[model samples]
Target: MTAAPVKNLTLADFLHLPYVEESPAWEYVDGVLQQKPMPKTRHSMLQKRLLTAVDAATEDYTALPELRCTFGGRSTVPDVAVVVWERIPVNDLGEPEDHFTLAPDWTIEILSPDQKATRVIDNILHCLKHGCRLGWMLDPDDYAVFVFQSQRETEVFRGDRLLPMLEGIDLSLTAEQIFSWLQVKRR
Candidate 1:
């Protein structure tokens, strides 16, 4: 006996299918399912801290982790997706919508060691192409960050350098302070 050949599923059918527990993380890209690498300890530490920092830093917008946002035939789970309070999609009941059918105002991706840099960058670029105002690619390996405002504009920050975030976000964060979160003191 042989397994059935995988078919290109429509978005409706894809959503209806039961999620695979082993591969909890899934993304539909160009009609194909892609499994994402599991985040390691360092990645988790950074993600958690960054999420908290960004969430509190902005009164105009809020940041969240691993939020699945769908648009343009792709469902991207950005590490952190920030949306302005007014722009958040709401249903008839005046509550947050179950499905995010639009791009985030800001998309942040923290590059896992095993993940391809280009693949991560591609998601950021995708968000930008769809009206995202800012994108941040945090590289834990080098304690550096890549800020992308536009297709042709980018800047690298490291050490004590201040990281560029969305305009109107009142947080002042430096690469060094962010990288220091990885430091753990043990007996």
Candidate 2:
């Protein structure tokens, strides 16, 4: 006996599927289901530090980690998703909507050891093609970041060079500064 071939899930079905916040996020890309790689210590540290840094640097935008964004017929969970305050949808009572049906203003992904860069880059490009302002792919091990912008070539940043930031955001983060988050200070 052989196992049955798994059927691809539709976007609606994928969205309707039960999800637990603590579990790895599920993504639907081109009618395929994928599980985002679990964040390791370095990845988690960068995600948290980047989110805090971005949020602290600007009041016009907010950053969230592992937030699922659906748009352009695909759903992706970026390591850090930044949305402009004005673009965030609110409900009748003025609370933020639970479901984000649009691409984030800035999509950030930190590369994991077991994750494939091409796939991550594909997601970023997908977001860019669908109105995302900027994308950053951070490689912790290399202490580098790849920046993506619509209608432009991808740029790599390292050392003291500042990474590209979304418009309206006042952050001036560098690759070195971002990678430095992994170092634990011993008192």
Candidate 3:
């Protein structure tokens, strides 16, 4: 269910509001607080696997799990956020900032069973509009993945079809392998 806006708020005002960082995860979009559905085992499995794969394969780009990104007049926490080494925000001591001020280079979202695909897609599109190079919406229920490239059409990848990685990432993964991570091993 969509969370209705309690009141119209500017980006600055919304940032000051408490509990956005606390679980259950809340997203601020269209001046409303939208609560993210709880993640199931399948959702957590895929998110972890993808982040690990992308992080290991690329040296210049790093993928972080559940990073809250604030940009494009909205604040959201992508399941995974991949940003280039230089683009990562750092403070006076060069440590990464608590919050990202710009859009991620790539954003990944895993679909919860009760969530609407359009809502996730809209978030991906919003990221693309503000300099996100790529986005992926993983739907475990449908066993399909939607790949979004900046300025291009959305493409669905399934089964053994290779999911595209970032320009220099060099990691080749398939939808089958991604979903397989959810399967528990037999003892």
Which RMSD values do the candidates have, in order? Answer: 3.6, 3.1, 1.3
Global lDDT scores for all candidate models = 0.81, 0.86, 0.87
- Whole-model alpha-carbon lDDT for candidate 3: 0.87
TM-score of each: 0.88, 0.93, 0.95
Question: Residue 70 of model 3: what lDDT?
Answer: 88
Pairs of residues at least 3 apart in sequence or in different chains that clash in candidate 3? none
- Local accuracy of candidate 3 as per-residue lDDT tens digits, 1-187: 4586777577778678786667767888888888898777788888888888998898999999888898878898899999998998799999998878788999999989888788899999999999999999988888889999986888999999888888889898898988888889999
- Model 1 stretches with alpha carbons more than 4 Å out: 1-7, 20-23
Q: After superposition, how far is residue 64 of candidate 2 from its true place, in Å?
A: 1.1
* Residue pair clashes in candidate 2: none
Per TM-score, the best of the predicted structures is: 3
Task: Please identify which of the two predictions, 2 or 3, would achieve the higher TM-score against the true structure.
Answer: 3
lDDT of 1 by residue, 10-81 (tens): 766656668622343677666666667788899889889988998878789988888888887778788889
lDDT digits (tens) for residues 1-187 of candidate 2: 1112237767888788786233688788887777877778888888888889899989899998888898889888999999998888999999999989898999999999888898899999999888998999999879989999998899999999988887778889888888888889999
lDDT of 1 at 94: 98
